[model samples]
Target chain A: MSNKVIKYILILALAIIAAIVIFEFVSNNPDKRPSNPFEFNVDNYKAVDETLISYKETRQIAIKDGIPGAIAFSHGQLYLLVDDYLQVILPGGMEVFKRKLSEKPNCIAVDRDGFIFIGFENRIRTYDKVGIEINLSEVASDKSHFTALAVSDDLIYVADAGEKQIRVYDKKLQQKHVFNGESGVSDVHGFILPSAHFDLAVNSDNELWAVNPGLHAIQNYSETGRLRGFWSKSSFENDGFSGCCNPYYIAFLSNGSFVTSEKGLVRIKIHKESGELSSVVAAPEKFSNGTKAPALAVDESDNIIALDFDRKMIRFFEPK
Target chain B: MSKLQSRRQFISGCARYSLGLTIAGVIGFSLTNASSQQWLWQIDPFKCTNCGRCATHCVLNPSAVKCVHAYALCGYCDLCGGYLKPGHIARNTAAENQLCPTAAIERKLIEEPYYEYHINEELCIGCAKCVEGCSSFGNGSLHLQIRQNICVNCNECAIARVCPSDAIKRIPADEPYLIKGGFEHGQTL
Candidate 1:
């Protein structure tokens, strides 16, 4: 071959060798990345101090067949909404009755008469203890979502997350007046429901309280749409509510303490009547990965019942 | 020109024709039935560790992978975790307090407290800084996803090969995204 031909072959060979070496180097060392100056991590928030947790796991009841929806405690019995079925279970885990429901319900509340009031997406339905349909309310409006229901002596208050307002109903499930969180009170921006996690509960005094989750506080309101008082604390510390919206779920203890559940950090806490953090019922570490807060309810005995959707069970927690 | 020579020649011709027919059939079948089942690389948001390798390892200049917003799962908060950096002093849309390095997130006040967020795909670098902050502090409405329209669909995904948690997976074309949803979808993470 000519000298020029030999030189051309050598150049081509050199380029091929260089290409192979570069590819091998990149594929073998995957961690040779550029340093990141802007750093943030969620793992730092996952750990909770032992001193903060004040409750222990007492017992757990497994729901095997269907997806657990919500739980309500009334008259020493636990009413569970699972799939399209409403089941009643005793404190000892003995099932009282299982009856088919027409459709899935967003929430459930039981009155002193043991009549279960079911909240669908936009309307309300009531059923007797024997599973007989008592009454059904008219649809609130277009695109109304009833996320929570609370029963009083003569009124049933519904927290409509869609409308971002509270609706009052008569004993027959007939719609009465609506409270749109406009108390005209100073600094009172009324229900700041960012998502569908708004909750409502009737205290022992028949007083009405609603969770203004976006504000990380529960507001006390009268049946006549007046803001009486509220207490709020937002912090990453154990004593305060954290995340975009917290106190995602709530139930009242017999003594009027608040059993609250937070979603983003996935912790359950008890707050005193004045809205001071009482103690930790369950820490972030207690729940499985990808889990937020579970649906919360307190029985007559004040046992904190957490409906664990991730674990497919209702966990009972008592003060340690 | 013997009988043995004639028989050998005929057998060779028959074998060559059979091989040609098989190759043609395979090519035809692949064209007809392989479109719908085509697989695409996606990040499983549940398993992703937010390692920030997606922005570095992609072959493209600006990675085809971008941030996705699930509005149904969003809280529409004024203090949005995905849009603002941690320890933010003011909740305004100041360039300094934003989490995204590229200024890809757009925030608008829909009402007194509710804010709507939109992703400007042209500016996103798939750095996952916003995703990390959102997943840690909020309902996790913002997550990383490979944009189908922008992706070149390489034979081997560069980011997937170097993923630490192995969160990247080959999902069907019909279901290309792995968006995170709440209990109604039977998923929390």
Candidate 2:
């Protein structure tokens, strides 16, 4: 071949290689490639005004020894689970009684008859009004990590986040049924507990409410383990729950409203029975920004009690 | 084969040489500009929710995000909230008693009640567990900052994509860091 022809061939090859390299580089650029624009606006909800919730701080109880874990209100008293001890305190922050547990308690529930149900790592324990321990671990699975407990007139529900199932029990603590994602019921899909923050509460109408954190939803289930319905909002707005898994802890008010506490954006919010955001019980500024979700409970009078994990205290808020 | 033909050939050669030099110069200038234009990832501390995504979502094996101690804000207490777990009884330096899962914070006795806490950046996973504890109970001195040297400076930072609070942002090469408390005096380190 001629030298001129050879030079032209080499130049052509170099141009083709450069074009291929540039094409690959441009195509792979993450910025140029179409991506789902993150819809949630973080700046809009950064600092919400505290006045949105018209509630007054009625009382504050300092928990000096242990960090607050789980909280419940029953029989006109407050039950606080701190470390391995369960302290029963009066509404005025006076300690009425305290008892130690053999295992670390992850959650606490109170029955109408003054019975206390404490859920440990692998089992459940019941106690009578006089502080007598009753064994209930026989029905628990080996891998159960009970994160929340709910008690009704004749039923008991334990939220095992580790197993991702809600174990139903009778008054005698006998296992009745296990509800999971594949429980064969249409709306009774299993729990999506990403972290150990699953929580459930029995509302005034006796309907069981469970938090499906991964979906950012508050689901309602019947006593028979059938799916009733669910309420969820996933906006960065104050009305909705945001973050990986939030509204981690939930409680029901006397009027069937839901009180929820969320981590990451640490705030306490009150939602109507229809899942409409009624008011803010406490703003994010009221609590330290870095604290986890606070344990929440509502008394019979509709007073909201928050076990502030950051401050290590119980704050009572009453409607203004 | 005349003298004029020879002069014309010489001019043609010089013109070709000039064109080659111009092309080379343009390529070199573009390469220099591309290399000089550097970008660094910065986290706006106020916007950071401490969601713990920095630890797992980073491109590096161990996250480039490290817990930075704002010495100006640190109290340096013996019972440092960032160093020890809440309700921890012992004041000694033990692995189990420390709040940090990786034990990255080093506590040294500077005086009677004061202690000097240093972060071992190599061991930090940027989980922000210590930052949470410190901000909640003690002074908000401990915070997470992405180290520019360790970061690969990805075009689209993985952590920023997943950050729930939208805290991460890109800054110019001159201002590489967004250290807390350093903004008042323009300190980058």
Candidate 3:
């Protein structure tokens, strides 16, 4: 072959290789590339509407440089579990009493007689009205990560998200029965806890209402661990629960309505006992973006109190 | 013809023929292997919704997903949108001032208005909090990508099962990573 022809062929090959390299480099550069249509943006956040249950923010109480964990109401007063301390406050936002605790408290419950039951990482500690700690080793287990606590006149229910079961105890704190939402309960498949967000609340009839977060359902179980009934609906609209695990926290009002709080969307809504959508207490725009799940509680006057974790404040909402 | 001339011609022909055959064989093998090889698990940053599930849904105690920074795209601003909160007043390393819950992103002062940020992969929980802040408020440089070395590559990834946005996907093994701000083609890490 002629030298001129050979030189032309080599130059052609080099040009092709350079074009391929440049094409690959430009195509792979995300900034120079076309924007993906599926990219999610936090700026597009839209708060859902407030329907049947309209709420007006009546008050806000500061937690004194602490993040609120769990909240409960007893004896016409609010009990807030903050960082290593339980602060007791009145309905008008006055500090009644405050006491420091040894272990970090995840959840709290108060009995009819004002006895406080605090749930730690793996055990339950009881405190009398006078702030004396009561030791209950029989009910304590390292295998449990107690995320929610509920006290009835006869039985004490502990919602263990770690073990995916509810442990029942008597007034003496003796382990009575274990309900995992499995076994003989045909309708109750099991609790689907994707994270440590499982919560439960006791209604006026002392029935256990556990938040089946994964399914976006509230399950009703008898004291004997029998699956009674449930109310659930899944939707992205304002009326229904949204996200993987929603309504992470639950509380019951005096009229048997449910006050629920969700995490990802960060909203509080009220639902009828039969799972009917009532009204929105606080919309997503009410709280800061990326707010964690707020602790929820309902007092006798039907006022909804939210322990805002992100803002570190205890806010009260009343029916308008 | 002389014997030496004939022998030289014969050897030249054989060498040219073998070179052609070798080139053809390499191209054919690469084409066939590229089509048949299985892909590994990867996260497409474009599809990720940052729902905070990547931190908890992984089979591992701490997820294999880690934040990767595209230095080429980064502005390297002293007031980094990813490192500081939206209304942060001071450019200090205080726990309350930083955006990351775990403080995984380390910031170094490069100059008066430029700072270099590095990700501590061990401390990252795959939450993508900083990525969200950076993308929404500043240059979209920081993003989440699954670390194949750390990922177990389960048949059905636990994170994929619960990912709300379905961002996790199986990509060709030849092109294992989907790095931002660069085109890798079918190159392997």
Best candidate (score: lDDT): 1
lDDT of each: 0.83, 0.78, 0.78
Clashing pairs in 2: A180-A190, A181-A190
**What is the docking quality class of candidate 2?**
incorrect
Off by over 4 Å in 1: A1-40, A43-52, A183-189, B1-53, B71-73, B85-90, B93-111, B120-123, B127-129, B132-139, B161-189
Question: How do the residues A1-320 of candidate 1 rate in per-residue lDDT, one tens digit apiece?
Answer: 99999999999999999999998677646466555443564455656777877789999999999998888888888899999898999978999999988878889999999899999889999999876787999989897998899999999999999988999999898888898775334554578766666799998889999998778788899897888988887766677776676778888888888889877667888899999988888988888765357998887668899999889999999878
**Model 2 alpha-carbon drift over 4 Å, by segment:** A1-43, A49-51, A181-189, B1-189
Model 2 local distance difference test score: 0.78
User: Which model is ahead, 1 or 3, in terms of lDDT?
Assistant: 1
lDDT (Cα, tens digit) per residue for candidate 3, span A1-320: 99999999999999999999998687545456454332233333344544444898988987766767889888988888878898888877888888999879998999999898888887778898755687553635666889999988888899998788888888778788887774233554477654455798899988898887656678988887777988887654566665445777899988899988876567888888888888889887888875376888887778889889888888999989
Span of ten consecutive residues with least summed lDDT in model 3 chain B: B180-189
Candidate DockQ values, in order, are: 0.25, 0.03, 0.02
Residue-wise lDDT of candidate 2 within A1-320, one digit each (tens)?
99999999999999999999998687556555544321112234656766777677788889999767888888889999998999999988888889998888998888888888888886888998866797575747677788999998898899997788888888788888887743224454466554455788888888899887656688888766677888887654678875435677899888888899887567889889888999888887778745477888888788889998888899999998
State in Å the error of residue A93, model 1. 1.0
Candidates 1 and 3, the one with greater TM-score: 1
List TM-score per model, in order: 0.78, 0.57, 0.58
Between prediction 2 and prediction 3, the one with superior DockQ is 2
Winning model by TM-score: 1
Order of models, best TM-score first: 1, 3, 2
Each candidate's interface RMSD (Å, one decimal) is 3.3, 15.4, 17.5
True-contact fraction per candidate equals: 0.38, 0.05, 0.00
Error of 3 at B94 (Å): 45
